[model samples]
Target chain A: MTWTVIGTYATAICLLIGSAFVMVGTIGLVKLKDSMTRLHAPTKVGTVGVGAVLAASIIHNFTFGYGSYHEVLIMAFLFVTAPVSANFIAKVNIHERECDTPPKPTVDEHWATLKPNGIEKMPDQPAQPSNGG
Target chain B: MIDLFNLPVGDGPGATFLAWSVAISFAVVVISQILAMVRVAVGPGSGDRILALDTMVVNAIALIVLLGISQGTSIYFEASLIIAMLGFVSTVALARFILRGDIIE
Candidate 1:
């Protein structure tokens, strides 16, 4: 009985926090201007917002149903992929010339996204030794 | 807990609080979904649209989890998980298509 009460309140708190973060994140998504700036917002939703809700689910299940950790799988998968997708989106912005071009690399003639193909050697590739086959 | 569909008030303070929180969160998430939809519709660039769509997917996942909590069941877990995976894949693919003019190559 005690654990039930505790779990219920815990779940409620988690739900509230999660919902608040999700709301804030989405608000930022709508309100922020510029594609690069817009990219900053939804990541909040991806990480903390969904994370807290998943925590609530886990707690609620343990308290009132057959407890399971399967939700963790979703959480982990989201965590792993959110940044990768975000990076891809940013890359798209760069490739499309939608966002500010990054500062010139000190060591390379062109940013990777803007680099002309084949005309210049790839910056990261080492030059072959003259004697090597 | 008060079921949103059934509208029965729960028996105790904890249940009542949880139910109310769940209801409020549902409203908030739905509002976020609408906001994201607006962004998707009006976004100036494809990146913005893609980002908004990603946000929508994340919000959908949150909505499903809330549904699970309200119904007091674990069965929805699989649905949310599949959505998460698919959403991520779709976001990456869309971005890649924009970047490279191709998804696989």
Candidate 2:
């Protein structure tokens, strides 16, 4: 009984948080002034909203004894693929002349999106630790 | 929990809460879906429209998951899985075509 209650609360909270992220992403999708900025919205959905719902599903299934973990496959696939699609879409935006003047390159590698190579480039930021691999 | 809320026809403890939460989230997702459609119809550029469409696909997946939970069914899970695959492939193909004028290369 106690575990059931705990699961209920957990599921509710996860659903709330997940839905909130989805809402925010939707708002960002439509409201952001730039195409690049709009990309940020679904990226949030990709990470937070989807992850939360998957967590909720996992909890609900486990608590109700329906056999959990199938949600993980969807979650993992989304996590792997969202960034990929985001990258391709960003490339599309850049290729179609959607973004503004290319920002100055921070390192030896220039912004790959700006080049015709079309191999894709991760935006350089001071915060990200480059190349975990 | 249903009695605590003083509502009739409760399924179980926290049933009302879970249902209400799902209901509210459903509304939120619906709002987003509408917003995405508006963007699609009023796109300033094809790129923007494509992005909007991409977002819509993802939002649909989220809605399907929520629906599965509310309806207490597992079939929606397969729908979401298929959407995930289709959405990714379509987005990649469209974007690739836009970039290089050809999808197969």
Candidate 3:
């Protein structure tokens, strides 16, 4: 039927697009110079790429009479959670690396603020030498 | 009316072949994911590893949907949904731990 052909063509198109994204992601994983750039690759490609392929499957299922919505629920779930998951992973990675430069501070800023609770200044203490004895 | 849009009346009307095409596409996604995993394993930085993990989760979701199509069942959908929910939770927990060094803080 015409619907079936339409579904096939649509699925093919989705597959092509998804594959392209996956390939790009893979290349980025290999070629990106640093952690932040690497994060962008999978987030851009992996989430949306799988989404497109899953959408195509849903269409194919509906057209073939395997039931109109067998795979739709899965598609919905993926859409809901994929981005959140990516964000989480990126955050964790940023945290674990503990790069010398904290994410919040800019290059020109002082690294840390003086605390008001610190002991009132004592007469400058003489430097003490450690005795290894 | 339904047959009006059907393809030129060849194998295009069959269900099995359509399922096969979906399977093939899913296979491609899985293979690409495995390639991503290689990066995860050899990653010189934690961020690259996390990126690979995220890619793996997405590939799993795609595989579940394709399974539903191939098997003509809704059960796989439920499993996929469960995975999605859990994956989101884990990712959030991990992220919080990374940023603040404690899940609660």
| TM-score, per-candidate, Cα-based | 0.88, 0.81, 0.69
Q: For residues B2-92, what per-residue lDDT tens digits would candidate 1 score against the true structure?
A: 4555422246568778888888989999999999999999998898999999999999999999998888788899899999988998998
Worst 10-residue stretch by lDDT in candidate 1 chain B?
A: B1-10
Rank candidates by TM-score, best first.
1, 2, 3
Evaluated against the true structure, the overall lDDT of model 3 is 0.62
Worst lDDT window (10 residues) for model 3 chain B?
B1-10
Chain A TM-score per model, please list them: 0.81, 0.74, 0.64
lDDT of 3 at B20: 47
DockQ of each: 0.65, 0.47, 0.39
How would you order the candidates by lDDT, starting with the best? 1, 2, 3
Taken over the whole model, the C-alpha lDDT of each candidate is 0.86, 0.78, 0.62
- Candidate 3 error regions (>4 Å): A66-83, A93-133, B1-10, B13-20
For residues B1-105, write the lDDT of model 2, one tens digit per residue.
Answer: 433323221366777787677778788888988998998998787778878888888888888888777765567888999998998898888888877778998
Lowest lDDT 10-residue stretch of candidate 2 chain A: A112-121
TM-score of 3: 0.69
| lDDT by residue for model 3 (A1-78), tens | 577678766765675666567667777776777777776777655466766766766675666546455455655666
The local lDDT score (0 to 100) that residue A99 gets in candidate 2 is 81
How is the predicted docking of candidate 1 categorized under the CAPRI scheme?
A: medium
Interface RMSD of predicted model 1: 1.6
Backbone clash total, candidate 1: 0
